[model samples]
Structures are given as structure tokens and as C-alpha cells.
Target: MWIRALQAVLDRGIRQGRLHVRFPDGRMGSYGPGAGTGPEAQLMITDPALPRRILLNPQMALGEGYMDGGLSFPSDDDLRGFLQIAARSAQSGRLPLPMRLAHGLRVRTKGLMQWNTLHLARRRVQHHYDIPDAFYALFMEEDLQYTCAYFRDDAMTLEAAQAAKMAHIAAKLCLRPGLRVLDIGCGWGGLALYLARAHGVHVTGITLSQVQLEAARSRAAAMGLSDRVAFRLQDYRHVPDRFDRVVSVGMMEHVGVPQYQAYFDKIHGVLAEDGVGLIHFIGRHTPPRVLSPWFQKYIFPGGYAPAFSEVIPRVERAGLVVADLEVWRGHYERTLRHWQQRFRANEPRVRDMFDDRFVRMWWYYLIAAEVSFTDMGMVLFQMQIARRSDAVPRVREYLYPAPGDDQRPSDTA
Candidate 1:
């Protein structure tokens, strides 16, 4: 029964790419090449229990089994390629109705177990970000940007791509000297310090992770910007001042559906009348029904990636205008490719930090994230928001510096 169920899932899910599975005792089967040709993937399941596991829940079993060594890919990177087919099969709506309905009912019938309440939020943030700095240093660029990096060109290095991302945000913001900027969910203070140095903006960065708080503060002091930028280990609700600009990059995803109204309301209360805000986050094409069970259990405890339709209404309800929104495709796919490459290259070092289970989980995390953008409906959202309709220029031309305009760093003091 389990073998038939596994084969049936592959037959329906894979339409374009080839997926071959080798069961124990020398039995083998293949799917795809019946539609179009692209990449082929092979999986070897050494443990007999895995077929039953995959039959119960293919989505969660693939992740859990891979971490447990029950499932094996040809290579570390091959799992990423294989997930591409799986994600496409899942998202393409080509599956039989019963399969779709069964999965839909599963997600729809359940409620999220984790909520980003103050205590839970702190714990969640710490669970993910409090890994030793050396672990992150192994994969991240010099800037240690844990979020998405903007790729200007295919040839740009990770370090260069990350720097361009900061510049891109700065461009959209139209920052001028001495503007007070509030950075919600600031990761390691990278963006905050960049804004202060590049635009002379005074930045107050708030985060829930003590690990990030101390690191960001240490970096600011080392760079002699102790007075210019501040990092606090606090929640967004406790931030005490209104700012001329607000930015929450890669952070709003954690503001679960339950907190959407309050999240935007806090931003609304603290934004200056003429101030504007930008939020960069991972979002889905459809309304998010619930968190991924494996993701919720292993990586982020209380995270929810809002859908376009789900969030805009809440932002509008907060009395903020959605001035402009940009959907970034392919960029995050490229970003994750780099991270995955780095991770696989340094897997030995990471294994030294944690057991093989932890390493496997991180590998799965990187591959899953990369393939989500590449194959699933996951995309990045950079939303430009403001209080008034006329706060920003009528056109995007102003966002681009006028010829010979001084976008350069100066005594912005």
C-alpha cells in the first residue's frame, strides 16, 4: 500500500522532470518524461519505514526522512533540483482533485500551534538566530546578510549583491541627511549601519534576539558609529519614538496573521506624517492557510509568510497607503543558490558545530528555500508605503538620483 501510494504521488506530482526512486530489495520505478524534459532526479530510500512515512505525508516525510538518513539524494545539491519538480507538481494544480483536496483539508482543518506572542516570539527568534556566529560566517558574505540579496547582474559576487541590496533599499527610501529611521527586525544591524553611514540617517534598530542585538551593537561600535546607530533587544511595540522613515526587511513574515493588525498599527503610530516605509519579505501567491508543518517544527517556530491579498487589506486598515509594491522573482533563487553552495562547501565545519541531524536540517532548509522561489509560488515583496498620497513623488523618477546628484556619503550630520 505504501509503495503504491508513493508511486501515485510521483506520477501525479511530476509532470516535466524525471524522478526515479529505488526502494529496498532492488525494486525501482520512474516517473515523468511523459510531459517535457528538463532535469532528472534520483532518490534512494535505504530504510523500509520511509515508504510508509512518505505515504502518510510526502511533504513532511521528505524533510524529516532526509534529516534522519532514511532518504538519500544523489548529492547534496541534487535534492534542490529534485524539490524543484516536487514544488512545481504541488503548485501547478495538475494533481488529481482528491490529492489537492486532501492536502487542502489537512492545512485548512488545522490551526497554527505557534504564535509570535512576546515570549514565544523571543524564543523563536533565538532558536533560529542564536546559532554561533561562526556557523553563519561559514556561508554568509562579509556583511552577514541573512536575508535576501539583490542581484544586479549574474556575475556579481555575494558580497557585492548584498551591498547592492542595501543601496536598492536606500534608493527606494529617498533618504536625506538627518532623517530618523526605524528598522524593525534589524538583523545584525547591517542595514541600519549602512543607512547611517551612507545617508547620515539616525537609525534605531529593534530585534528580539539577544545574539543579534549584541552583535549589531558591537559592529556599530567597531565602526565608530556608536552614536549614529542604536541596536536594542526589544519588541516593535516597545519602540518609543516616531520616525521619519520606517523599514522592516525580511521581518514582517514573523508577524503572524494574528498580529497583522497590531503590527501595522504600531508602524502607523510611529511613522511621521510625511514619512514612508518599505517592507521586504518572503510572501506567497495565495493566501497562507497555515505554516508548513516541517518548517514550523524545525526552523521558524511561529512564522507566517503573508499572501499579497492577505496583507494589503491589513496595511490599508492600519491607515497606511500602499504607494508602490515590487515583486522580486529569481533574485532570491539566485541568493539561495549561493548560500546553498557555501553551506555544502562548509558542511564539514557546520557538522563540527552541531550533529549530522542539525546539518541535514540546515541543508534541507537552504534547498527548500531556493526551490520554493524557483518552482513554487514564493516571491519577495518590497512594499513602499506612506501616510499620505502625495508624500512621495508622483512618479518613480525621483527615486533615481538626478544626474550628478550627491547620493554619496558625506557629513550627513
Candidate 2:
């Protein structure tokens, strides 16, 4: 009975591509058009009860089943191909009745689910970022920039692109010597150290994760910038100093919907009257919606990538002006693609670190995130904000000078 139910769900969810399924009882079934049509994928079910679980909660069940060795593809390459087809189908398909109801419930109750109180926020940060730092070093670039890289040129390597990302944000901040800067959600002190070394600024970076705090401080000391840069294991809300510049990269998603006002207020409070800041985050072009059940449960608990509409109002209410907003389409997709390749290349190392289950989970996470940026409405938003309109340059040209224009915007203008 459960097998029949799952087949019906798949028939509706995958009309554009073929999903060939081999059930636990050796019964074969296929959904969508014949093999000659669009993209095709095949999977085998190893557990008899998996069908009922998937029927109840397709997203969560599928991730868990894959991790637990209950669901698998014919080959490693087939896994990515299957995910692509599934993502495309989900973009244009409807969930089953039970799943739809559950999705709606999550959307309606998202505020409660993502409250993210101070203590709760710390716990959630440790849940993901506290994973052994060595494990992350295997896949990430030398700088350990876990956020999206700026691909200025299509041919740039991951390391070059990450450097470009820092330079891009630094340009927006309009740095000068002896300026005081604050780095919120500073990951590994990369950006803070960059600001100090490149711009000759004094930087204070804050994070909730102890591992990140230690790694960031050690990097600062090694770079001989400890005097110019500082790392703290503190929340943004508790900050009490003013800064000439502020920047947060890939950090706002964890600031829950309920805390949006307070988050902005904290930024507003700490920013000088003439301060300029930039926030880089993953945001959706679509209307605000609940986070994916699988992602929230297994990856980023209490996290939500918000819509621009959900953020702009809070910025306005905080008395902050949006100096500029840039949408980066296809950049994160490429970044995730690189990370996925690196992860696959180091699959043996990862498996040795944990087990086969951890390998499957990470693989699913990387592929799912890549597909989200590709097929879904996900994109990166680089918002330049200020306490006053005159804090930044009146023209956007300052952000993008000619190739050989090496001087600062103020110096050139």
C-alpha cells in the first residue's frame, strides 16, 4: 500500500523527467515520460519502510534515507544527475497533500521556530560551525572562506575568487588609514585581517562560535596584525562600541525573523553617525518562505535566507539608508560547484574522518545547495548601507573604476 502511495506522489512530482525506482520487494516502477525524453535518473530502495516515511515527509525522509544507506543511485555521478532532475521537477511540481499541509504549517509557524534567542543562537552556531576545523580545511580554500566567493572573471580559481570577494566588499566600505571597523559574524578573521592589512584599519570581529574565535585570533597573530585586529566570542547584540565602518559576510541568515529589528538596531547603534557598512548574505528573489525542512533539521538549525522585502523594511525602520543593493546571480552556484568538486575529490578523507553516513550527508548537502542556487530563486545580495545618505559616494561609479585605476575613489575623484 505504501509503495502504491509513493508511486502516485512521484507521478505528480516528476512529470518532466524520468525517475526509475526499484522497490524493496524487487518490483520495478518508473515515473514521467519514457527514457528518451528529458533528464533521467534511477534509484533503489533498500528499506521496506522507506516508502511510508517518504510519503509522510518527502524532503526530510529522502535526506535521512540517503544518509542511512536506504536510498542510493547506480553511481556517484548518477547522484548529481538525479538531484538535478529532482530539483527541476520540484520547481514546477506540487507536493503531495500531506507534505503540502506540513509545508504550510511550517511557513505559518516559522517565527516561533526561528526565534534564535542568545543562548539558543550559540547552541545552533556550535551545531554546524563547531564541526572539526580540519574537516572544513579539506574542501575550503586556504583562507577558509565558507561564504560565497565573488567570481569577477569566469576563469578565476576558488582562491582568486575569494580574494576578489574581499576586495569587492572592501571597495564598498571606502576604507582609509586609521579607521575603526567592526566585522560582525567574522568567520576565521579573514575579512578583519584583510581590512587591517590592506586598508590600515583597526578591526574588531565578533562571532558566537569558539572554534571560529580561536582560529581567527591565531591567524591574526600569525599575520602580525594582532595589534590592529581583535577577535571576540560575542554576539552582535552585546557590542557596545562605535565604528566608522561595519561589514557582515554570510551571517545574517542565522539572525531569525523575530530578531530582524534588534539585529538592525544593533547595527544602527554601533555604527557611527557617518558610518558606511555592507552586508553580504544569501537571499531569495521570491517572497518570504520557510526554510527547507532537511536543511533546517540537519544543517543550519534556526536559519532562514530571507527575501529582500523582508529585510528592506527593517533597514528603513532602523533609520538606515540602503546606499546600494547588488544581486549576484549564478555566483553562488559556481562557488558551490567548486566546493562539491573539492569535497568529492577528498571523499576518502571525509569518510575516514566520520563514516559513510557522514559522506552521504555532506554530499547531499553540497548538491542540494548547488541546485538551490541554480534552479531555485536563491541569490546573493550585497547591500551597502549607511546611517546617513551622505556617508557614501553619491555615484556608484566609485565601486567599479577602470582596470588600471589603482588609486582609492577619494584620491582619484
Highest TM-score scorer: 2
TM-score for all models, in order of appearance: 0.93, 0.96
lDDT of 2 by residue, 169-243 (tens): 998998888889999999888999988998889999999999999999999999999999999999999999999
Alpha-carbon deviation at 157 in model 2, angstroms: 0.2
Worst 10 residues of 2 by lDDT: 404-413
Name the top lDDT candidate: 2
Q: Which residue pairs of candidate 2 clash?
A: none
Give each model's whole-structure lDDT. Answer: 0.83, 0.89
Error of 1 at 276 (Å): 1.1
lDDT of 1 by residue, 16-76 (tens): 7888889865689998874456567888988888888776667788899899998889886
Off by over 4 Å in 2: 34-38, 91-93, 410-413
